[model samples]
Target: MSVDFGQIRRNEHLPARIAAQIGSDIQEGRLKPGDKLPTEHFLAKSLGVSRSVVREAIAQLRNEGLVETRQGVGAFVTERQSRTIRIDEGELFKRDSFRDLFQLRIPLEIEAAGLAAVHYKEADLERIDEALARMTGSEKWTDEGIDADLAFHRAIAEATGNDYFALFIGFIAERISLAIAAARARVELEEIVNVTIDEHVVVRNAIASRNPKAAREAMRAHLLGAASRVDLTLETY
Candidate 1:
């Protein structure tokens, strides 16, 4: 069966949008299991995007277990039974899923912050500072701001010296960022952006000081504040 690929109009989150489009094609049976996907060059040309965007989209599908690449060949759809944990981005923004996912995220990130405080190298600190600086400098409620926000969290996870922590946090943060961007769209108040930047600064300072307790508390506080900004009422501990 031939897949009907469309031109990508929006510039923001190009890889994610492409991944979603191709994933929908798979789920709807336009692309069947074991069927090889078009080459990166073909997809880029058909979709009016760069080859790098197609590559990133394919990477996302691979991470979600929807596609597998053969060495020196091409990517193919995976059997449904062999697929791993799949997160539907559309469903994730629903209120219950958003709140529940945020709850699960809290403790994992708090622990990561503590571990980062103890384990972070100078380079890790520099990465975190750079992300924070970008967030502080960006326009309020923009995609660039959101990307910087996620980068700050990802940097902290990387600093933990645990590959699993970085992996899991990176996965969760990618999904959660979609919901966060949606929430920001709804509430585009300058005050909220200022508060978020302040919260990140506190977390950065705690980690830099090598204070595990302080780092954990700062992370918890920042996350809770984030929930409030999104109008989510998560149970506070």
Candidate 2:
């Protein structure tokens, strides 16, 4: 079968863009389940990208359960009728897209924090504390520190006793972390890092106190502060 793959523009996150485009094809029924994807060499040539980018894009589709690869054969669309939610990384760089994502994040995370406050076990608390400690101990401007920050939030999501919550928070947090890292790049890194740590501490303290309302409010404040740090203006409600 002939596939009309578009040539990719040179930009950051090339692989993700390719994956998003192919994923769109799958979701829209243009690429049926069991339809084999073009070879890496062909995709690379068609898209005007390197074979490595094509490989990574295929890897992404596999991770999202939209595609399955057979050894030495090729990649084909998965038989699953539904595709998992995916945020196009390229869109995250756009102002409106970032704002929309952050807006969605507010209610979801606020609720997650409240639920965590109500349901968190001692072990959950320890995980949260461990992540916090790692963030505090790591270099302020390093990827390790950012990862620790994500872990801290993930721990709270896990504490909610909801696997879906954990899954979504993990996905959204990963994408937002990219935006956060970019924002941090343009400012006083040390200052932003310190403020972020302080905000996390407030959220953690509220959860630890087992006050759902307080935890919710703390999370709201922290998320709002995060958006502001990124120079994005979001409605406060």
Best-fitting candidate, measured by lDDT? Answer: 1
Task: Residues 97-210, candidate 1: write the lDDT tens digits.
Answer: 767888889999999999999999999999999989888885335666766777799899999999777767766776666555555555545876888899999999999999
lDDT of each: 0.79, 0.79
Worst lDDT run of 10 residues, candidate 2, spans: 1-10
Listed in order, each prediction's TM-score against the native is 0.73, 0.69
Instruction: Put down candidate 2 lDDT per residue, 1-237, tens digits, no spaces.
Output: 111111112322456568778988988999999899999999999999878567756856765778988999999898866557666665666667767988888888999999999999999999999989988895446755766777788899999999878867766775666555665665688888899999999999999999999999999999988887667778876
Residue pairs with backbone atoms closer than 3 Å in model 2 (clashes): none
Candidate 1 TM-score, true structure as reference: 0.73
